[model samples]
Target: MNKLISELRRTALVAGDRVALSGEHEQFTYTGLIVAVDNLAEELSQRGVRRAALIADNSPAWIAVDLACLQAGVALIPIPAFFSAEQLEHTLTSCGADTLISDRRASDAQIASVLAGSTATSAFESQPQFRLWSLAVADQAASLPLGTVKLTYTSGSTGAPKGVCLSADKLFATAAALNTALLATPLQRHLAVLPLATLLENVAGVYAGLLRGAEVILPRVQSLGWAGSSGMEISDLTSCIDHWQPDSAVLLPQILKGLIAIAEQGHWQPPTSLQYLAVGGARVAPEQISQARDLGLPVYEGYGLSECGSVVSLNTPAAERAGSAGKILSHCDVDISDGQVMVKGNVYLGYLGGAELDSNDILATGDIGELDDEGFLWLKGRSKNLLVSSYGRNISPEWPESELLAYAGVGQCLVIGDAEAYCSALIFVTPGYSYEDIGRYIRECNQRLPDYAQIRRWAALPKRLTVADGMLTANGRIKRDVILHTYPELVAHCYPGIVYPIGGSQRAFTPTQTMNSQTDIDT
Candidate 1:
């Protein structure tokens, strides 16, 4: 048996009545959770389910299904409900899953269409919250790498998301490391903020919380006001946090920004029950981190990728350094190779349908980072995103972008300057803010950056960069190539001799000119 299951059983035997999982309207004690997992595992094994796909909202049943799959030795694939129809089809078909278990009713046309040809069954009749269907797919056990138990897909910068193959041991190893790091604080109750399908939330949030014997809150995605990867109702989320008063939670940088905005506007205050609020999914601005701490939010920054089984390093209350990704977790050893971060231990098996990787092979993270003298991992940006100026100076766009994001007025932004004399930016202003607000923020950001990396020109986009529009990943990271391809005219306007519509007039810039005044730059 896997370590996760073994630990769950041990906890159940010791504290059977203790609440292990809590949903919006239901709760499960440790004993109840184990019984549910055992029953579902037996059903899956009886039905000969080689590989299973799960699609459901955040709920106790979701985790029960995941645990059941692990115990039954069935490969499980979690399909994000927010994925586009094309992506959904690709994942369901490509993973070679023979069974699909989901709570979504047949009324959802999009999901129903995807399940058109599958055969319906009563395999999970005892579990009223979900339906089990058998898919007529070819057996693909030979194709998968040995010991592969979970297949997770990341909504990358491209349309086709690849499935990351991970073993049960590696997944639990990451959870163990995270649990060890947090032993100092000892979380009692953890609220699920991100979608449970997210690998980070699955391993770090659910697995680690369970190992620590803490109550895991699993509210529906709609209740949290999450819409896809880019949209969220911050007010609803903060209200939920206030209602639950959870001791631990995880968040993306965008969510943290929203919380900071609401707190700054005096509309809401962070609950004191929150002990450790970990922020990940993307690089967060140092200024934002400082602002959150000032407002009494216990925010910590961490870094990870699906390739590394979710969390590679994190910051705990016992040991932390703001702006860094935190000391590397005990499960992995990190090395800087050619300015890129490479991880050796506790790495993934390989991508689905790809050659199996040896256990000792180093995984290049594609991110540029370094270890500090105190063992903190500091991230710069994506190695491929480095911009070279006409003056032969190399700069990372994330440096200036992070500064602009420090101001709440700038909702989303991207720095652009390749072979150009100076840097330029594409900014999306917040709803209540104006171009002037973003212009001033850019000026402030420029002051902090060197001349070569400063934003000398900028254009305000008409609409927000959203996941639906293919401008951002579901986790709120900007898709640089997609944005560049989508708005060629606006990009050209930032260069020279091109006027693009902004507000009520044309905004253009000249070569070798600096935006010293708010009016001088068109945001």
Candidate 2:
């Protein structure tokens, strides 16, 4: 057995009566958790389910199913609830998943629709808060690496999402390192704010909490203030924190921004019990970090990717730098090669249906970064995301975008303009901001940026970019290609010859006229 499952059994034996998991309608002690996992694993083993797909909201049953898969030695594939129907079908079919466990009736219908042609059998149960389905054929010969235990699909930049194969040891090691790095105590209570489908939350939040024998709050996403990929209710989230008073939580940059806004409004404050909050998923503005600290929120920034099994490095209370992702964890080795961050140790097996990544070969993280003398890693931006101007100057959009996000008015900004005279942006302002307010904030940001990277012109988005709009990934990273394709006319309006009216109208201009006007603006 792997170390994680063994530790979980030991924890259950040692702390049998202690609360191990909690949800909206149920709670489980360590003994209860162990019993639940064993029961489910027995059922799955009896059914000969070698691979199973899990699609459900955060709940005690979700954790139980995940643990049961580990116990049963079945390769588990967690399908994100936010995935499109087509994407979901592709994952299930490509992975040759033999069974599916999901909580929602709507999800059951969706799954049935996807498997309509197959001779699949279905069963409903109330105790586990999910229905079970057995497919007609299982692709017993699915191509996967040996010892593959988990298949996490990435929110792809284009086409269907790819599955990232990971071993149990790699994931457990990450969790154990995180638990040690954060100084997690057995008494600690962790709130699951992000979905379990997110590897970061799965490894660092759920796994770490289990490793420490900590009580994990596993409420559904809606109960935690998440509406969709990009929408959140700050008031609802603050209420959850105040009520739960969890010792630790993991968050994305946008979620932290929302909480900071509530704190700044004096409507809420970090609960005294809240000790460690790790923020990642995107580049956070240093100023925002300072603001969070000023608000008495222990917000620490970190960095990682799915290929690295979620967390590569993190900011712990014991060792932290303001703008860095913190020192690389003991589980991984990080180095910068020609401006790209390379990772070794605890790396993933590889993408499913693709080349098997050799562990000996250093995993070239597409992100650019630098390691400080203190061993802290600071990320610059994605290497491929660099924007080159007609003047041959290369600029990272994240640099200027981070500066823009520092302002309260700017909710999100996408900097673009490759081969153009000057840089331009598509700005998405927070509610209650006027055109003038956004423009003033942009000007302020422009002052801080280099001339080549300054936003000479920009247009406010009609609405926020969201997963529904195909503009953001499930974890909140911007889908640059989707945005560019979805709004070509709006992006073009940022150029000099094209005019964006105050009422949000687009007008095109002649190429020669546009070039001359842009040259003048550049000068």
Candidate 3:
């Protein structure tokens, strides 16, 4: 009884021949798309797959299998390709997934390790692009809430991520709201930029686009220039955008920054066809939004979490505020209680193995924000991330991080000052930017901040924080605890007295000091 599938059926009857999905090697019309879903759903039902996990890159076939699971009334778990082998094993085992659907081979070393305890059979003949494995592991004692359809895991900073159980009704409600939000500039060709495993892209990008009957572009992640979690080739991304000419896309803040760099270089121009480019997954600097607008990129900032069905508020062409997260979506009722953002009306069923919520239950989002007089929701930072300086002054790391990100040279940075004399930063610069460039940027950034919040000492990281190293989540949010645990030396080096051994040509500095003053530290 999924309304989205029913709507897809209705759309197919009228526009059966219209293109619904386009991938690198294949295309599916609306009619063809339905047929594929039906065939796979029938197979899944016959196989008695109560719960299944999907692991694959973005493609038309991936979408087909996803819809198939929905049609078959199977609870689906989507594990991102960027997840470590440990995470993959944890998800499959924790969710009691009876079957696994992936594009990876059964003989793959990582796959083999996770599937070791279970008896599995691959159905590679039926699905050419994907392998279907029936697992015979003991049914887990944990149970999903009644009516749960999709168990989407948040890319948590820890080794074991939690799965947010959601129903079809919740997902479609958010998608419907997103579709309505984009009514002013209807999408014709929507590109899938973020991995479909990401709930934000799955619900907002795919479901919303499909609701509007717009063509959803599903290119391979590599072709889109995605290199794992923290790396991307901006040139390849620009070429994809130029070639696809998509009218709509969802981007992470880093991607938007890269696009701005390309535009500033005058090497490329963003496609005029891109009418709506939604940026989220992190706090986007207002300066970045201004630069994007100046470059003709229709960038809108939105805010949401997986527990709220992926999106709660968005900045649309019709309604937008530069520094705000945007007006709350129609499907959501947001209230600020005790300086925390609480959401109701469109929350999830519950987490995996957790108590299900009643209809009246409110979700404490753990984010600090305020709703303006005009209904725009402006976010401050995460309440859990608020740092208390040694001076007893409260500071939000996101405040200084956002300022650093506004500059083109500063790629990624995290401000740390909890119980410290003053703020310190760990920085990763983009190519062609030197330590002096970053130092100058931080000095300028410090001028705008109060004395307590100003970053006094900084150090260059040997490399960017990446998901593989457990320093960043799949969506590129820094794992503060993991970074603190793994880089104790780097953190020590940022302080006034502590000296730590660091390899590579990295250096720790004060804004006013030259590199020659501090000893060279290598990563």
As a TM-score, model 1 comes out at 0.76
- Candidate 2 local lDDT, 1-523, one digit each (tens): 8788788889988889989999998999998988888888887887788988888889888888898899999999998765656667778878888787777664364465765654434443325456667755445435888778999975443235678899998899899888778774333799999888888889889998988999999888888887644457878888898888898899877678778988999989788898888887776778888899899888888888788888988887788888888889889999899999999988889888777876685799888899998789998777697664533334677777888889888888798876465678777769987656766677776665545567777766667888886789999999887676666665666774545333233232222444334322221
Tens-digit lDDT string for candidate 1 (1-523): 8899999999999999999999987889999999999999999999999898888899998999999999999999988765666667677777888888888776674478778877678748447778888776755433678888999986533345678999999999999999898889979999999888888899999999999899999999888978655457999999899988999998877688778989999999898898899988777677888899889788998988898999988988888887899989999999998889999998888888887897898999888999988778999877688665533234677877888888888888888876465678888878998667877777776655445566877876667889997888999899998777667655776776445333433322322223334424532
Question: Which runs in model 1 stand beyond 4 Å of their true positions?
Answer: 138-142, 385-523
TM-score of each: 0.76, 0.75, 0.77
Give the candidate number with the greatest TM-score: 3
After superposition on all CA atoms, how large is the RMSD of candidate 2?
A: 12.1
Worst 10 residues of 1 by lDDT: 506-515
Clash-forming residue pairs, model 2? none
Q: Note the residue pairs that clash in candidate 1.
A: 229-474
- Residue 478 C-alpha lDDT in model 2: 96
TM-score of 2: 0.75
Candidate 1 local lDDT, residue 224? 91
lDDT of 2: 0.77
Score candidate 1 by lDDT. Answer: 0.81
Residue 373 deviation, candidate 2, in Å?
2.8
Question: Where does the lowest 10-residue lDDT sum fall in candidate 2?
Answer: 502-511
Which of candidates 1 and 2 is the stronger one according to TM-score? 1
Preferred candidate (lDDT higher): 2 or 3 = 3
